[model samples]
Target: MHSLPPLAALKAFFVACHAGSYTAAARELYITHGAVSRHIQVVEKWFGVNLFIKQGQRRVPTPYALTLARELGGAFDTLSDIALRYGNGGRNNVFNVSVPTTLSLKWLLPRLDDFYARFPDANLQISTANTEQLHIIGHYDLLIRRETSGTEYSAIPFLQDHHCLMASPALLKRHAIERPIDIFSCPRIETLTRPGQWNLWLKAAGLDKSAGNGIRRYDHFHVSLHAMLEGIGVGLGPINTLSQEISRGNLQPLFAKITVAPNQYYALTPVGVQKTLLHRAFEDWLVSQGQRDIKLADLPL
Candidate 1:
């Protein structure tokens, strides 16, 4: 038996705690910051416990509050699941999906028009935070991420972000490059922000050195890709990540034979658990789209 907290207050509390900022929580909840603050205080007064410690502008959760918060979050997720399953007639399918920026922009958004056109009733909420921050298994209804664990979901292999040595043709043509060892000893090496990506790629590609010197890092893929596109330096990027550019003649691969990176883009489906029709439809449609793209990408490499 659960003693129900005030629905509004609990909602506010969950958002505030999850977000770690009342103002941010208010924006997500579509209410004013004062309302969120009032709701939390109301809950605190009702329970005779302090849930938040105000340190200047930040709200720190007390130990009790943190435990309560986890419970509250679990409760909300359960209620959300119930609402998604039974609140409407196969519609009201608001599915929350967690995805990486690389897939979100390049792949998912481009194919989403069909989904919207077919199932206009389904509403989708996409969380754009990197997979490193959000638990793909914990909260989201679906996650399209680089396949790390493989057992995370229904297990669609989808597309491989194959690691490759790519650079602008001008850079390659100017420098004589025959062996993998040639990449290092260059002036600058452009690489992505992922942890150990550059070093690991170099090592996996059978390069001479693992770390130390000849490495320039960029926080975003676009920045690194742009540097490579402008003929600045060599970039070790995914095969699929460079496919579009290669087609457009903006970039070229150094080696024809590629390695499906130790990492890959993956799609996870939350099926079997009852959900909104929109969610199910979107999941099915996404898989269908992935199937369709495989045919489109049968380009001669």
Candidate 2:
């Protein structure tokens, strides 16, 4: 017989580590914070090590806890895939995808008609979730995400995530922002989730951190982009996400010569499953369409 911690304890530990708090885990698991705490304690006692430490009113996962959580997450993902594929007798020709909302709005939705035209028989169902939780790999057949280093799944690079400063034409003219440094005089729109984006882009452009002043923060990139479009301030815009806006003249690029090293958009599939015909067809179609979009966006007026 195999010995292991109780399944409930393992699940609580996984959710707590991922959610970053017992309360959040409790909400997600439909349990109380006290129950979440007790389950974690059970796991910690079974392992004879502390999984989390109290840090200034927050429960932070230890390094060991993070490692264990990642492993457990992967195991759960595999089990989910198996159950979805076999236990329920998987549906035919239906492809489910998880994507970030901003990407869905700015990039994917615009070109979906072409996807359907090419693959009429394929029923594509897309769901959106917070980008941070994407590492969990739920029931979706595929996930489109910003490429991160060292992922366990098979990934196909779809779009280059080149970033640059973007602002409405009205804002630029109003601020007389002729140069990159001039942007500091105007409000700087920021995405709360990617706090370091402005810093990284400014550093790459050879500007000091102080140049990113007059800040307005938004919880999501889409909101920040909307604020920028409303002539609120300049924002760091990734090419894949903002290309259509630039093309439509809703927003214009600033300091075009100064660009950051491109990150990538990836189409991630479960490990060892990329060889399937349906997965390959969709990946190929997606990549080809993305390449076309990038080419058109990169062209000079």
Candidate 3:
């Protein structure tokens, strides 16, 4: 560590590379572009190499810069997490959760009345975003994600289901889905933002590849579900989220055999957070209820 680059310069280089621009990185750090540039220059000088390649108007990072960026990004995020955890000297009973909006709305939201009933003293907050930003891992007490695994905490397999082609009774009746092959004559299927999901679901239902053409797609499941709920068209999506509507006779499942989605439901939290009584009771209840739907070794759908 005798002749190391200045920490500021190192940090600036990391931010610039990670953010893909000196200006954006500077804005995040609340500093001048000149200051960030100077720091990058200092780091480059100390390394005796170029960290970034200038192309016409764009700043492209070199191979060396990419590797360092991730480490520094993690470092900065870790520091932020620690700062917030220590800074918050709040009541012990407060709990926070984050989940994707569609999952929260369809499965978790309608269901949280029970959690509150079980742990009346605990205050709960839920956020609905899928990505685990570094700050969130430290801030949120529990996070619901549709992922294959968990990172730092224990993961509970909450709910599992396959993607089903479904639509409002109003739409299906008009379109008339008498068989899987009949889908081609109907309105194009809708899906969450994930690419190729419609094609996969159609193929699973034994329809020909021609059946997959011209399918409309959206990124968020909420959008797709909303489209289906409003009688827009058939949608390929999770069964659990659409359960209530189907039960209410407002929607109809096109096929009972669904195409599997890679991610089911997972509970993520830091180590020991679930052990707390506030979280424990809710976790136990949630898992027991979910077990009725999901089993690890068997084919889930």
For residues 1-301, what per-residue lDDT tens digits would candidate 2 score against the true structure? 8999998999999999999999899999999999999999999999999999999998989999999999998888777656555554554555778888888888888888887887787667788866646655456778887764465677888877777888898897799877668888899998988778888888877789874558999999888988999999998887667777878998888776566647778888766453456678889988887777554245442
The regions of model 3 sitting more than 4 angstroms off are: 1-92, 130-138, 148-151, 212-214, 272-274, 292-301
lDDT of 1 by residue, 128-179 (tens): 7544543543467777766545444565656655566777888877877676
lDDT of 1: 0.68
Q: Where is model 3 poorest over a 10-residue stretch in terms of lDDT?
A: 292-301
Candidate that would win on TM-score: 2
What is the model-wide C-alpha lDDT for candidate 3? 0.70
Give lDDT tens digits, candidate 3, residues 75-146: 777666555444657444556678777777877777777777866776676777844343454467777776
Off by over 4 Å in 2: 1-91, 148-151, 272-276, 295-301
Measured against the true structure, the TM-scores of the candidates, in listed sequence, are 0.62, 0.66, 0.63
Best by lDDT: 2
